[model samples]
Target: MAWSRDEIARRIASDIPDGWTVNIGVGIPTLVPRYIPQGREVVFHSENGILGMVPLREDESPDPEVIDAGKNAVSIRFGGSFFDSSVSFAMIRGGHIDLGIVGALQVSQNGDLSNWSTNERMIGGIGGAADVCSGVKQLWVAMMHTAENGTRKLLTDCTFPLTAVSVVCRVYSDLAVLERDERKWKVVTLSPGTDLLEVRNATGFPIDI
Candidate 1:
């Protein structure tokens, strides 16, 4: 059984503690808030300027002016507060957020991340990853295990420019849920159809699933 993307989001959401302030990054990171049940008392912060964002509207149109750090159109929710980019970033840098969920293109065994840029020269951006990775106590990375060409993103070491060094705590992907153990990655849950050996072959890093 493959790990459905929505199931991955729900699993990540379950890990979020009640009363926590979470910073959801671009990509699948945004799906976390949707899985968080109402009355959970979780406060969401976006890098652009919204703190306390509600779950995305089911049928509402995207707003041109309101956007996230990724510049995706967003809707404002009640109890949501808007601030300047500097102030919002200050909240992340000042360690106000408890948990951060970010999407990654690659992650090293020591928890280094590279999500902003691919091999392509023109579309790279580091943005707020460094700040969030270093500042937050808990960081969760979500992405596919392998590239379309079948190259693994979980590596013994990263080839791309790193966003932050040794900052990730856990990873959720189409394949499994993994955690960094000292200098190696430990697989916690195997995806339905995946076996341990197959995952081991995919990731060059030494892993005990």
Candidate 2:
């Protein structure tokens, strides 16, 4: 079976080291915090200005005031702090964040990312993605391997407008986890019941197993 969205998030969370500050992008990335191992410290940063964001409890009511970059209601951890967008952007631009977990529309073989916009809805949507991708020490993408129509999103090059160039260090897709190794895409791990052949077929570029 392919890795479910929650499973992919869990995989990414398990890979994150303790005590690292992370920025979670929209989509599947929002699921990361719920899977973080207990006793581990992962400082989650939201572009809107929250530094200690947590997913709302299952039965817990959302605080209309507390939300994430996606504007979804979330709770805050005890040590969490809130700031204005200016300070938040400063933190992002200053590269204080250790890891940035983002969702992608496409990721090129060279690690180029195109996530903020597409030709269809091109007016606005360029949020802090550009700054986060460019400034973060490491950027990990969590997304589906292909579009709903089965088109590959892991391409030799991105067709959509670029968010930032060559910034994606790793990708956690429904099918597998691929990492940049020696300037080439390498299969780090495959989803349960997912084989190399399936991943190879799903990827748009050559991948080293």
Candidate 3:
């Protein structure tokens, strides 16, 4: 059984420390704000220039100007502040963000990330990923274990253009949670119905259980 996108978001939320300023990247990472555990206060920093983001409301009309890096309309907490993109990137590059949650195309055992584009075509601009990866104190990736074509994404080397090298500290996929140390990748947790053997088979590189 594969973890749903919400489940992956929930898993990632559990790992985020309370009181930390977090920058949620586009895609699955944007879902993380909704799953943050109760009793914890996390200040969400959007690359598009909003901080203290709350969950987006469906019933309520959205504010066009209030959006995340993905351009998805969002709500903010009581004390939220808005600024220009330059100020936002400054916050990211200044090393003020504690954690950065990003979606990745591929990650190597050595913690390299390649989420920007594929070799076949350019999907979109790299955006602030390069800065977020290098600026945050810790970087966590949330993505599918395999591509739509069933190609393994956790590999010995990323075929896509590198976004940041040796920057990923952890990965949360539908199949498993992996952590990287200086030398190797380790399986921290496996999704329900998945075993060490299954994870090993899916990944292109070896992972310690």
Clashes of each: 2, 0, 0
Cα lDDT over the full model 1? 0.84
The whole-model C-alpha lDDT of candidate 3 against the native structure comes to 0.91
lDDT per residue (tens digit) for residues 45-148 in model 1: 98888988765576988778887777777776678899997998899988889999998888998888888777765244777888888888789998878887
- The residue ranges of model 1 lying beyond 4 angstroms of the native Cα positions read 59-62, 122-124
- What order do candidates take by TM-score, descending? 3, 2, 1
Tell me the lDDT of model 1 at 4.
Answer: 75
Cα RMSD for candidate 1?
1.9
lDDT of 3 by residue, 75-119 (tens): 988889999989999999999899999999999877899998999
What's the TM-score of every candidate structure? 0.90, 0.95, 0.96
Q: Give one digit per residue, the lDDT tens place, for model 2 in 32-68.
A: 9999999999999999999988888889898888989
Instruction: List the candidate 3 regions with Cα displacement exceeding 4 Å.
Output: none
Q: How many clashes does the backbone of model 2 have?
A: 0
Best by TM-score: 3
